[model samples]
Target: MADEVSDAGTVRADAWIWSVRLTKTRSQAASACRAGHVRVNGERVKPAHAVKAGDEIRVFHAGRERVVVVSKIVRKRVGPPVAATCFVDNTPPPPPREFVAPVAVRDRGTGRPTKRDRREMERLQGLGGDGPTAR
Candidate 1:
């Protein structure tokens, strides 16, 4: 039935995510849920999990976590303006890029790196020496 599909009061987690533009596509939202990248109220949920207003949702994507509190339920994808009002974003700002050290660059015509140069570069990358310790 139409009411069964739309639910009127609640929406599927993946549908809600895509409808609100949290992800680029509905399929991506479903994939995220299946990969354990989505959680509702601190519990991991599948794509079909019901999402309602006031529920807190956390989505991990693109190396960042997006925390949002649902304020509205929508089943159909909407424009950005409308999507913006569906959730209250609670995610912290990403860390500054300046904190990352610059990578070593070789000049043109420098040819291949010698063993010593490679070792030095590896050390600069913190992947040299003994490497990571075993668990």
Candidate 2:
């Protein structure tokens, strides 16, 4: 067993996750527990749950859940890379966001057009080409 220091010489799992910026805040961590968004050792856990090194932890966020094993106990918010060191990612991150082409459109206006028409043109400036709406 590792001897972790705390205010009383011990650390809480929920607090640790909060300080580590895993879930934003301790209360939100607890809310995650209530919502069954967190698990330990393949079982659901509460905010007051106790965790030790080598334990498997999972967290849900942004429409996805992450699973990792406890490598060490840390009570400070570290950089992303350092935070990444806290555990091993069990699953790959979600797919990269990509823009999908919008449905075909027949733009309005004919002559010089109105100010709104010009703004619309700027908005669709990067859709591969000028598009059917382009002049």
Candidate 3:
């Protein structure tokens, strides 16, 4: 029976991370998976591991991580169409994000710039020619 096929694994953790447009590529997803940062249903798993609808997952990225539940899957790399099928966020509610104004970094004088550096700086500043008005 067609139903006999396992409909399990709504999404592979790596594929989900990859298709959701998280990591740039599937290999990166696998690497991330091997790093042991991803957890399914509260347990660590590998990249090829699969997740099914209602399965929960946790992913740590950058400085912060998120937890989510699998809602659906798109085996192929997906665009915005299947976006909704991917999953649901279930991370523990976080406190208000703290925003700290950055202090402008000043590079100490490392001697005068070479001719190329000066030209590049001039172009960057748009001193060479007319460009879009600086916001």
- Best candidate, lDDT: 1
User: lDDT for each of the candidates?
Assistant: 0.85, 0.67, 0.68
Task: List residue ranges in candidate 1 displaced over 4 A.
Answer: 1-8, 104-111, 127-135
Top TM-score prediction, candidate number = 1
lDDT of 1 by residue, 31-131 (tens): 99999999999999999999998999999987889999988788788778877877899999988999887697888999999877777777778776554
Query: What is candidate 2's CA lDDT for residue 82?
Result: 62
Q: Better model by TM-score, 1 or 3?
A: 1
Q: Residue 37: error of model 1 in Å?
A: 0.3
For residues 61-121, write the lDDT of model 2, one tens digit per residue.
6577877777766666565666676666686666666655444354555556565655565
Per residue, candidate 3 scores C-alpha lDDT tens digits across 19-87 of 766567888778878999888888889998977777777887665687777766556676654654566
**Ten contiguous residues with the weakest lDDT in model 3:** 1-10
TM-score ranking from best to worst? 1, 3, 2
How do all the candidates rank in terms of lDDT, highest first? 1, 3, 2
User: Which residue segments of model 2 deviate by more than 4 Å?
Assistant: 1-10, 79-81, 95-135
RMSD of each: 6.0, 8.2, 11.3
Using Cα atoms with residue i matched to residue i, what is each candidate's TM-score against the true structure?
Answer: 0.79, 0.58, 0.60
- Weakest ten-residue segment in model 2 by summed lDDT: 1-10
